[model samples]
Target chain A: MKRILIGALFALPALTAMAGDFTASLSIAPEWRTDNRDSAYFVAPPVVPVQHRSARQDLGLRFRDGGFNAQGTLRVLAREGQTPEQHGIVNQFYYDGDLGNGSGYTFGRKVISWGVGFGFRPLDVIQREDRRSLNPPPLTGVPLAAWEHFSADKAFTLVWTHPGHRHEATDFRDQSLAARYYRLVDGNDIHAVARLSGRHALEAGAGITHTSGEEWAFHAAALYQQRYSKTFNTLAESGGGILAAANPMQEVMRRNGLKAVLGSQWTGTSGFGVLVEAWYDAEGYSRNEWRRLDALTARQRSLNGMAPASAINGNVAWSSRAFERPNLLRENLLLRLSHDDERWKPALELLVTPRDGGRVITTRLEYQSDRQRVSFGLRFLGGAADSAYAQAPIKRMAYFEWRLALL
Target chain B: MFKNALALFASLLATLIALPALAADDIAALLKRADGYRLLEESVRIETLVESYRGDTLDKERRYTVYIKPGRRSLVLMKSPAEAGQKVLMLGDQFWLLMPDTQRPLRITATQKLLGDASTGDIANMTWSDDYDGKVVDEVDIKGRRCLHLDLSAARPGVTYARIGLYLDKASKLPIKADLYVHSGKRAKEAWYEAKTVDGQLRVMSMTLLDDIQAGRRTVVRYQSIVALAAPDEFFNPAALVRNTLAGW
Candidate 1:
């Protein structure tokens, strides 16, 4: 650890020298919401039913300089009723500096790249909660344990991209090693990419990831990620489970497997377009002892104890710019339909502009089961032309958002 | 005699219809002449004001003291507030903005779009010739001033503006007014320039831009002075874009 720290410190200056330019901005927003539900959990019997109106305000500041960037957000939530009041500060800082030539170094909380082509964010990293009291208590120890803490290992990612396709690499936080290829077939341009990734675990474990895709108006991609890590007492304790005792012979098998995604976007000269996407993900874990333990008792095992579970999702969206104007206002309408086995979600959005150069009004309606979220907003888009020396001001639309995540 | 005159009138009408096509090639050649004066280094002060469409609304203004070297190398130092030394510098194709608050310069990539529509294209990619490929389309008088009108088109696609029509003062041979057409068939954004003789050289002192998209929106940029300065090559790097002090305001 000390040697790694020393090496990172030594490489910092070289990275700084290679890195150029930075910018930052700050924003503040105040929001209000109302709800009649008391918890995000399901129970057979009602425990405590609560009704509440809430108002919250947050200040967000973002700064990026050279190879370093930082963001700080502070949120204060005020609630009424039987629920407890909550306030918290969420701060995230990231720094990526060149280590030399093509190498780089990063610090603080950031997404990690795993393996040579695979990336895995442990479930813990994905669900770190700064304020837990704001959420209802979980019923099981597994969910409760998963809810309370952050990742133990600060993730580290190293990536490389083919020289010609460096732009695509940056989109995924520069953790891609892919080459972009193009061909002309029957006068139509065809583009494709292939990438490989690998993740190295701190405890002598590793995983591999392979992703490849061809995109034109239609895009098809396939991804496979597989990883394994040894089960230890610390992990058992962290997982808050008796897997250590119940299946002592079982080696903990942690895996995230993904399948192919076929998607397409069609936007022709008419400015009207449709995008359709479908993907399948097969994921979970397997171990001999764990399987035997699960077979022995129903009370001790959960449905996710199965070795593999597959999820399929599809989305279709359509957009049109049939009302576009030359210099004045442009208008577009969009409709989306999505389904992921358990949920069916649909949304309709309409954007209207009085003229090519004026303010815009937008309306959105989304529905999922019994939950509905509707938003009507207005925005003053920037002026249509450039100035002699200065740039235009940034614009944002006023909106209302409501989300219900059913477990 | 009447039959001969009718035939001559027919020939003149044919020439009138074909004149624009013949002149188009010449306009492209003339635009190349402007491109030849590349690799300029200058230190200049620029003041900009953006007016709101509504009356009595406060306009936006900014001031910058900038130094630009050849190859898109530049350092802009803001002079207004007594803040720490934060500067914006561009070296090569990379850009950097430095902030006094953080004491660091962040690198900016060219892929990032500025103001939504304009890509952060290579600053070095710009030349007077590359921007406007045109020919002398006509000679006309505007407000009793003889002017040479050139119809220009973009040599390459994806540029900020597609077409530009320049009206140069015939006597001064300098652009007095320019109408920049964005995309294609769009209403043109117009800019009127005022020139002055400085240090025995003709230079633009002030320019006003009227956006065709908005009937009343306008922006004016005034140049206060120009000076000569020298700086290191690396100072204009992408990392310099983050230097707040270097950003002239």
Candidate 2:
């Protein structure tokens, strides 16, 4: 028995030697906020004077080696609000392994494919807001306490690549494939995606996204990208969205349809370039359906008894880095201009109704220092819109915003 | 005549013994010569193609007219997407960014590390000159290519990685591979360089980084082109880091 105990002790060193590399860091940020508006629900409510503060702490740990890697992160937010104190925790874990040759396996709570154009949204968290019927509540305080809940959305992504391999020689040869599967904890939703792409000087690929749940949807897109010159290139994509589930709202409004987008960017010069995007939504009534649903479901209605029933919006922006400095720092100054339009039909029991259309100009300056970044910007809103709770119409407002990182 | 012959044989034997030592010393000198260009000033144009595991690929290509003056300063200026100008400047130990729209420069922390090849080493830290004193350990062949092996140890605390083993190409006298160990006695991370000659100079055209512990995941950085740069002294000034022209770069 003593000899056996000695043998077990000897194995401990071998086990410890196999333990690989690890790194970890912790960050805490506490913020103080003063807002003129009481809450997100109050549209132009008399600017209230209020002070609030919150702190968020984040921790990340990583362990990696030749065969596998494991990473985890935890984030906690604690807030002192006017209504009640609130705190929340979020955790994520990821594990991946090499299948050999240019393929790999990954399991985690990660971003999955299920969108059109540049607007692909990941499935992770869902937020719901509470509303009242009558004069809208002030824009301050916690919006919805009961609606906050954690959802388990886990996914697996299988990735393979030939031309995109890290080695330059391997990238010169083409062969790659990627597949993804995702499901929500409630078993209410499932998403599947598959993509096969490569570079043979001229690159082209196609993908399909299928989603089924309480609300079923399907999306298919094809992309073509080509490098024309040393400084010039182009990419084009086309896709369609379909609702497969039957809904009384969809039948009443004929709202199920397709959305498409086309965009391009050019980088021929030293400090100046342009990106232009154009989009079209074929189902016009979809906007009206959403607005009507929002109005009907609002827990609290504004005093003026106005509720928006339908709206449509379009916008454009331009950015440039004409002024720049050379050093370890990379900075760019950008200016943007945009315009939007919306039409609101009041709920049946309301008094005033009007179509709101307006133009907005936003200018922002951003600076990035290594991993740290900061941005400050000003926005001017000019438009005519209907008010939900107030008898008076909403007017234009302007404000400046700033964001910073502590570490 | 017998005594004379004995002395001659002894001299020949000594010469034979010293030949290997002389070759080893020559190789070490060659490696030192290769490490001589401590500072490099250049501009880079990069095109990135990101392929997602889900089979989707994104092409984000950018051009930067940059100035990298070793240990002292680095600057980057962007020239496309014409709405705002952005610049980043690093002077000495302090870093700053300038925004054209707001015209403000913000300070940055040194602990912030970018997720790229440059982040793996204190290549930008002048203190690296004192971090690890390097010595030629031995001569070995890597993948059939003869190389001079160098072992480096930390001379001070906070030197990023703890130990580094470099395998330098004997023919070109340039570093071909590096095994970097971090966190004071942990395992190492390996990086391999594929070099090409451009404009009469040997430069790392492409590099591959592999986690020594993790099997299949690696990152590759390819240098599309590099141009020699002549930068103004003010470019490295910390005060200029936040200027609209400097920040927007």
Task: Identify the candidate with maximal TM-score.
Answer: 1
Instruction: TM-score chain B for all models.
Output: 0.64, 0.62
lDDT of 2 by residue, A270-313 (tens): 11223233333322222233233234223223322342311100
Q: List the candidates' TM-scores in order.
A: 0.45, 0.33
Report fnat, model 2: 0.00
Query: How well does candidate 1 score on lDDT at residue B57?
Result: 48
Candidate 1 local Cα displacement, residue A230, angstroms: 18
The fraction of reference interface contacts (C-alpha pairs within 8 A across chains A and B) present in each candidate is 0.00, 0.00
What tens-digit string does per-residue lDDT give for candidate 1 at B16-41?
77566647555544543333222223
Per-residue accuracy of model 1 over A1-407 as CA lDDT, tens digit each: 33433453355445445433322221222232222122111111122222224444333333455555554433444454534333333243555554332234444543221111101111111121211111111111001000001111111222232222323221222223322222223222223333443331111222211111111133344443453333322322344432222223223445644434344443221123344443332322222322222232222224234422110000000000101111111121222222221122222322222222222222333332222223232333333232100111123334344432110
What is candidate 2's lDDT per residue for B117-172, written digit by digit as tens? 23313333322343466666666798888887777776644344668787777666
